[model samples]
Target: MLWLKERGIASVAESVLNSEELDKTVAHLLVAARNDGYAQGYAECSHHVVNALKVDWDTSKSATHGVNTEVALAAAKMQFNNLQLPVMDLIDVALHSEDHVAQLKEIFPDRQEDEDEDLA
Candidate 1:
């Protein structure tokens, strides 16, 4: 996301980017929010929380192709069901899915980035 990217955390591999890093990134945003500075940013509290879930890398591997997005999306769907979002809320699910994919894309923009960043 443009907003999250601005935080300089956008470069971190989304896979293996656990909730800790995400939470730290969010903590900074929360401070900005309390100061009313994050209002102009793209991510809101709910979006950040959902993004955190959608981007979870709780497994033992790094970015895997269709796997990450698919699983994350399916999980988000189940979460939406629990949240009781209406059928018209398809957009929300799709948006979160996009967020998941974007996170993946940001993960491996180039294969060499890992070795370069010492993430491998």
Candidate 2:
């Protein structure tokens, strides 16, 4: 009887430890996902800003001898500010994207694979 009780306690302890490890893994994955989403959003916004600046500079050069540094800086700053909302929206969409789901599955495949096997 004592051996059985000790075995039961050991089993419960192992289960709790496994649960904690799983929780930690999930937390790490969520942080990674958020970082990746934010990076994608910022990269997209930066690309747009760069393309716009290129076009603006090209037009300005054709119209004038040279671009004004102060005006260019101000315009770029204003455009960046205008894009804040779109950047946030992109980040939100990225977080909920199929790519994000695939990323999570890629990072943690063993459990899902096992479940798939069980179902089959």
Candidate 3:
């Protein structure tokens, strides 16, 4: 993704998005979210969470579509415990959404405004 590429997290984001295992994807995102500093990692992982689940990785969509609810719930809990603030909202929307990509867009918002400001 453009955003991930911009942040130098595109490789990990690609891996996270490409992975078929829900638990593994969530685990990878958590590690990235924790390890790469809050803002950068969270942005990258969260964006890919939406993209991965929305795209569902493979043709059938079953791979990501049927992600274990327990894993998602646990991931949400851990994120809230660890990050706090607006990230909790982002996590909640992502885990609960019927359409994760759209929900994430609404909740997390794009950095376009910030990017524009930077250019200015």
Best-performing candidate as measured by lDDT = 3
Q: Write the per-residue lDDT of candidate 2 for residues 14-109, one digit (tens) a residue.
A: 544556544555555555555555555555565687797774322323322333434544554455444333333443564577674443333333
Q: Quote each prediction's TM-score.
A: 0.17, 0.31, 0.24
Scored against the true structure, residue 62 in model 3 reaches a CA lDDT of: 33
Off by over 4 Å in 2: 1-18, 55-120
For each candidate, the alpha-carbon lDDT, in order, equals: 0.43, 0.47, 0.51
Rate residue 29 of model 3 by lDDT: 64
Question: Please, what are the lDDT tens digits per residue for candidate 3 over residues 47-120?
Answer: 68779788533323432333344454566556545643444455566758787555555544556766898899
Stretches of candidate 3 exceeding 4 Å from the true structure: 1-86, 113-120
Report clash pairs, candidate 3.
none
Candidate order, lDDT descending: 3, 2, 1
